[model samples]
Target chain A: MALKLYYDLMSQPSRSLYILLKYANCNFESKLLALRKGEHFGEEFTAINRLQKVPVIDHNGFVLTESVAIIKYLSRENLIPDSIYPKASKQAARVEEFLEWHHAGLRLHCAMFFRVKFLIPSIVGQPEEPKNIDGYLRRMEAALKEFDTKWLGRGNNFITGNTVTVADLFAACEVEQPKMAGYNPCEKFENINVWLKKVRDHFNPYYDEAHEVLNKIGKNKFKMASKV
Target chain B: MALKLYYDLMSQPSRSLYILLKYANCNFESKLLALRKGEHFGEEFTAINRLQKVPVIDHNGFVLTESVAIIKYLSRENLIPDSIYPKASKQAARVEEFLEWHHAGLRLHCAMFFRVKFLIPSIVGQPEEPKNIDGYLRRMEAALKEFDTKWLGRGNNFITGNTVTVADLFAACEVEQPKMAGYNPCEKFENINVWLKKVRDHFNPYYDEAHEVLNKIGKNKFKMASKV
Candidate 1:
């Protein structure tokens, strides 16, 4: 039986998981739960994840939520190569460190920027509030600066040392999210810019495919023409 | 040489790491970083962690940060029994899922509530901002409710499943931090109230010892006498 992945491409984590699953070349069922249509909040979907968050996976009888956990779990279950998630405890710990820091660091700031700049104005029919996004933008900027200086080690191919681990995929998806608002937050950081391209190129078709919906939305200038 | 642990008891993650280290019965050198004195932001600490966050560890010269990652790394390094963090991939993923969700969920809300309700007012010599705490309190309440209803299985002892994993230790620390402000948010939730005692009792002297500073600060009503 194939693994069942419940996701919505518009979600940053969902896109990361999509790319991960595709890259792993695993047999999985893709179940789209559109957030714009309130599909995720529906009773049917609630049975899968009461939290109503995306990028959940149901393998065999085991069900898991949280993109990082799902990716780590799937990595082990599918016997994915160590280069992606790593098997060595120390290497894995480095990846874990990035994953843990990401939640409050890049993930929070990027999502906040996207929500304030695009999601709110488009969905709520309200004008963009400068004060609302000011803090998020500042935090986003700080996080990006740290990502370049601290996490992105000198000449390191990925966030956690050499190979592109799950951390890179999750981060790239989040950093790309604010771009939907037509603003590239990491545009000034040379290292981040270079690393972003490396991650995108490594994932290739899967990355582009997973981001198609978001790209279309971004290209449309995040207008309220579409519900989500 | 004992593993070096850099921590601040007042910080939630720092306390979590302290309890985990003691519970594992491992030899570790405790290096207290007084946040109130601006120790974490100093030059010496910056060399250890550019982010200047607490709850970092140096084991055999391999320095690591992020409480969840540090705990996970230590769990493997010390060969602690599975009952604490677990070895099975499925079981481990559940713990990871909780830890990840915690960063944005309980940990965020709890820490924010503490900062707004106690830290900012006491330290900055400003009045407690009720408006700032409102959203955080609501989110904290919602997180606790979901934690009890969804994560805490009926009749189950811990967050994920039967055994108390690393998630419980980290969670108990965060949930308890707000108590220093003379507010026990989880006191209203029956399951959490029960689980709280269970987790607290499981760790015993170590749990109580790790919380000594915060407990004293909490007892003094978080007066501005100390800078933190």
Candidate 2:
């Protein structure tokens, strides 16, 4: 019996997991939980995740929620790495640091990205506000600058160093947005572009499928609108 | 060289780590990163954690951010139980799941708590905004009610299972807000109170230490003024 993933392609992390699973060749059943339709909050869906969030998973009798954890779980279950983890005890802690901060820091950018682009019009029924997006872009730009100055070393592939941690994948998928939102990515943070290219070069096969999924998010003609 | 943690007592996660460190007896040099002074945004501090957030561990050359990651590092360093992580893969994954969800769901209560009780006065300079507090309390009440209905499994000690995983510590410390906020813990949910007491009993030393540090917050005596 394969584990079931409750996901939405429109979600960044969900798209992430979709990419990850495609690469790993894992056969977990994909159950689409559409947030646009508020399917995540339904009683049946709530039974799977009491918290009523997307990107939940059920493996055997055990159930889990939260995308980062689900990604890590899948990573560990497959051939991802302990390299994404710290080699030394302290480095492992730093990975955790990034993951935790990712929630408040990088992840905030993704939410702001969607909210400004898609959410206000479709979900919140508000005009696409520039100032709100400007504020978030400032934060994302600051984070990218820090990524260049602090976390990204002189020559490293991933966020916590080389070897493609989930942090890299997480950051790469998110940074792809500034351009999509008409906020030039390369101009904002040069190193972020460099790091992003590195992530894509190594993770490109994964991205081939993911880009298709992400492209469908705004444009309805792709596979997303046609399928569940 | 003991790891140095720069933190303010008043911070939700900083207090959480302070308690964890105390209970575990980790060799860590503690520094108070006072939020009241906007010390977190200072150049020197941002150099330590570019996120400019607290509960970071500078271990030798590597700086780790995020309290959840720090806790796991402590666990691997054997400050806590190996059983907390367990040898079983799925079981360990469950722990991470709870920790991941901890931020999204549980921390909303803290967000509301800070926005109402702390930020309104601290940022907006408003005095005793009962309406702000009521908004937070109502949200917390709803989350806790759901937690009771879905999460608790008849006297489960921690969020995941019987043992005091990192999840329990994070949840317990956050739930302690009720005492300070003058909100009723038992008015709606029985399980949260039960879980609270369980962790408090098992991790009393850490719990009590955090309480001592946190009790000092919001008091005017301690250089409690903002520079930023």
Candidate 3:
């Protein structure tokens, strides 16, 4: 059963699936792409995924994109345990609920803030407009506020429930992105800070492993800013 | 099994799920909310869903939101036929791929275009800035182009395959929205135009019935513009 995962750790969804695959103990070849270097646009990668996005999987030639879909697909194939992705109809729906909401909610806001505040400036060799940064930051904060109140506010240990599920993994990964832009969500949102630590601790080694590159970049970004 | 669906027919996802439920012949109680009436904000509706969004379902007291999640949950419980949602792993992934992509792709752009061009203007009782409409229209057009060339361009009759699936329903509903703003996709993209017709014909009465409110609004919008 040849399974291969093409991902970039810098990408939030890519890191989420990477941590998931590792936690699930699924044996798959990791084909990493450097987003900064424009590797995803290469002919080879484009052939694999015409969308030219990361977090794609090729399982014995049945290719799939979209981290949410891929995670669920893996769960259906039993590569990931039901504990991580519940099979019980209602339990699973709870996880699915968050996954679907996050697409336009937390994921969109966090990714946008990261891109506008950190990525675009770095790539273009100049800082983005303060107004643009502030706009995206506000949207990100509003999304985070909703995330803190609606999802974690339920008083559960995690997004869906006490146990860490794929929902937590996806959320935590997205929450970590703005850190690269020197935005600390943990500083403002108490529940998010606590839940994030819990999720990271739950999947440690793999979680940290998947984020190694991003953490390095984040630290470097902070150090450079401090020096400036 | 008591299944209750709280939805606004004007909402695209709500319409998609409404049509799916009807097509599947599921006995469901429809709790329609007139979104423009601020009914979703009332205390009674807030008690049902604090998010105040339509396309929510309460199945035997287990409430779920997010149309994609609701559809999948129903499919898992056998409320939706496999032909519509597909049970096979690969086939299901294909449908899921489009659903996930559309969240930020077609859905975001199309919804934004509709809001900027029509809904926002009507709600505020004034016209929006032409620049705003142009920007959103450009994004929507780009998204529609990708939707056409990538999703429907594979010479397949539908988004995922030859037969209509949940993916097609979601896309068709989203595609129909820009019409309210006087944007006719059929005139620009032949593939989308054909596929939309096929999907609507397949689901017939349900598809047209669910679209009744939006279509009426669209017609009035056109008539008013022509008069102007």
Best by DockQ: 3
- Angstrom error at residue A211, model 2: 2.7
* Candidate 1 lDDT over residue span B142-206, tens digit each: 88777778887567899887788889988899888888776775668888888988999999899
Report the lDDT tens digits of candidate 3 across residue range B1-228: 599999998899999998999999999997989899999999998898888898899999999999999999999999999998999989999999999999998999999999889898989999998976888999999999999999998989999878889999999999999998888888899899888899999999999998897788888888988999
Provide chain B TM-scores across all predictions: 0.92, 0.83, 0.97
Candidate 2 segments whose C-alpha is farther than 4 A from its true place: A1-3, A42-44, A78-91, A124-155, A177-187, A216-228, B41-47, B83-87, B123-148, B153-155, B177-189, B216-228
Residue B51 C-alpha lDDT in model 3: 80
Reference contacts reproduced by model 2: 0.72
Candidate 3 local lDDT, residue B112: 91
User: CAPRI band of model 1?
Assistant: high
**How far off is residue B201 in model 3, in Å?**
0.5
TM-score (2 decimals) of chain A in model 3: 0.97
Which portions of model 1 show Cα errors greater than 4 Å?
A: A222-228, B222-228
Runs with alpha carbons beyond 4 Å of true place in candidate 3: none
Model 1 C-alpha lDDT per residue in residues A4-110, reported as the tens digit of each score: 99998989999988888788788788798889898998999898889988989898868899988887787777545677888789999999899989999888988
* C-alpha DockQ for predicted model 3: 0.88
Local accuracy of candidate 2 as per-residue lDDT tens digits, A56-120: 87877668778777766665565344555334666655566667777766666656765676566
DockQ metric for all predictions: 0.82, 0.53, 0.88
